[model samples]
Target: MQAWSMTDVGKKRRENQDSTYVKLDHERNMALLMVCDGMGGVNGGAEASRIACEEFARSVWDTLSGKISGKEAVALLEKGVSAANMEVYTSAISDPSYMGMGTTLTAALIVGEDAYVINVGDSRAYHLKRRAKDKLKQITDDHSVAGDLFRKGSITKEQYDTFPDKNIITRAVGTDPQVYGDVFELKLDKGEVLMLCSDGLTNMVPDMAIEQVLKTSETPADACQTLVDMANRAGGKDNISIVVFIKD
Candidate 1:
């Protein structure tokens, strides 16, 4: 597996509230990718994102260090996220300054040809599989108000685009005392790619555009840079973070 990641303070945002981490455990043939988009005013958002990512990564590394099965590793990942959520929530409650601080988390762990995905809030995980010479498929869903409205048939494609609160997430880590994340597993082939990104990239670049770029790019780093460039060209309204992993 090959991994590439980057985070940028977009054209508009004064602070980069997004955080990302990617690590490969060669001995276990496992790779981990995590992205978090924090929410709050001033530096609180960035702090929350940093804390969530660091705690989650530390917990996962510690829990999975022993000889554990793949299923057990997956369970450990969930527990790590839950622990991070509680820590963030408790800290925010104790400190009135970070009262409403929260963050969206999406993580992916790849072992052999199988990948496990877990997500909370609107940050996304996408699986890009080559169907033909020029076709790629995206296998993930956004968890936002606009996504819900679109799913419920209450909003059309145009309405989703024009929705004022499209960035408002219905659920997020640290927002509630306990956070539940959606988990998924995927079987990957040689040419498959897994992308984990904050809403900044998705809100600016459409899924089809992402597929095209991933299909055209020669490497994971190139794909990640191209996506970031495309998002910036499309107004760059928020902080952007992206991680791309390709099966070798």
Candidate 2:
């Protein structure tokens, strides 16, 4: 297994509210990748994203503290996500400055030949494979109004481009007492590629363009830099974060 990740503050943001993590379990052959985009004021947004990334990854590691199956891995991720939400929510309510602090979290766990994805809010996960014609297969759905409209077929592609609420996420970590994350499982082939990213990359670059980068990059790190650069070139309106991994 191999991976690369990057986070940027973007052109307009004074500070970055994005965070990411990547770790590999050599013994169990489990790889974890995550990205978080925070909300609230400056300190709150940064802190929220930091807590979610650290807590969620640690909780997941603890849940699989022992041996687990693919199904159990998925359940563990769900439990970890809920725990992370509670942690953030409790922290937000405890402090005055962090009143409405929250964040979007997207994670992927690859064990052996199976991969599991979990997401909340607007951050996303994707799967790419050469056998799939070099298309970026989006694995997570954004928990936002635009996402809902796009999914329900209520909005046309052209309409979605101009639709508002694209950034108004319906669900988020730390915004409520509880938040449920969506989990998906897939079979990972040797050359399959996975990406976990914040809205920064998607909002700036189209999927087709992203797919081209994934296909042409010589290394995962190169792709990571390329994506960040692309987003920065496209006006860099928000904090950017990306994690790219490949099954080897």
Candidate 3:
């Protein structure tokens, strides 16, 4: 497998509040990827994402130290998300400067022929394959007001696109004493691509455009860089982050 990741402070953001991580183990044939998009006042957002990522890495490292079954892998991803939430929540309450800090968390774990994913807030993961027209599939759902409305059939596709509060997420790490993440499992195959990214790229560039870039880019790293550059070119409205892994 091969992987690549990149994060950038877009044109409109004063500071980048996104954090990413990627771990590859050739011997074990395993890979881990994560993306976090932060929200809060001033310095709070940046620190929240940094703290969440650090906590997530520690939990993943400890839980995935040895070979684990599919059941254990699912449990491990949940633990990682919970650990990150607690770390950010505790820090936010303990310090006045970080009173309302929170962040979106999305992770991808690929081991053997299986891939596990966990998500909170609005950061997402996508599955891309070499296929006919529709090559990119969004693997996670947004945890936002707009998302909920759409799921309940209260909003139409046209309305969802113009929803005024689409940016307001209903669930997030560090926002409450207890937080839960949506977990998923996928059966991966050779040459398939799994991408984890912050809302920066998704919000600025549509899914169709993302597919075009992923298909045209020559390498994993090139695809990642191209995604970031494309988002920036489209009047970058937020911090952009991209992490992708290709099963070989």
Q: On lDDT, who's better, 1 or 2?
A: 2
- 1-248, model 2: which lDDT tens digit per residue? 88999999999899999899999887878888999999996599889999999999889975676567877888888987888899899999999999999999999888888889999998999889956466789999889999899999999877776676689999999999989999999988887889999999999988888898888887889999999999999999998899999888
Candidate 3 C-alpha error for residue 211, in Å: 0.9
lDDT of 3 by residue, 1-248 (tens): 99999999999998999999999998898988999999998888898999999899889865677677888888888889889999999999999999999999999888888999999999999998856565799999999999999989999977987799888999999989889999989988887889999989988888888898877777889999989888999999999999988888
Global lDDT of each candidate: 0.85, 0.89, 0.90
Indicate whether candidate 2 or candidate 3 has the larger TM-score: 3
What ordering of candidates by TM-score runs from best to worst?
A: 3, 2, 1
Which parts of model 2 have CA positions greater than 4 angstroms off? none
lDDT of 2: 0.89
Best-performing candidate as measured by TM-score: 3
- C-alpha TM-scores of all predictions: 0.93, 0.96, 0.97
- Cα displacement (Å) at residue 212, model 2: 0.6
lDDT by residue (tens digit), candidate 1, 1-248: 88999999988998999999999887777888999999985777887888889899888865565455668767977887898798788878888888889999999877788888888888888887755564455455567899899989999988987799988888887878998887888898998889999989988998889988887789989998999999999999999999999888
Query: Predicted candidate 1: what Cα RMSD to the true structure?
Result: 1.8
Candidate with the larger TM-score of 1 and 3: 3
lDDT of 1 at 185: 82
Poorest 10 consecutive residues of model 3 by lDDT? 61-70
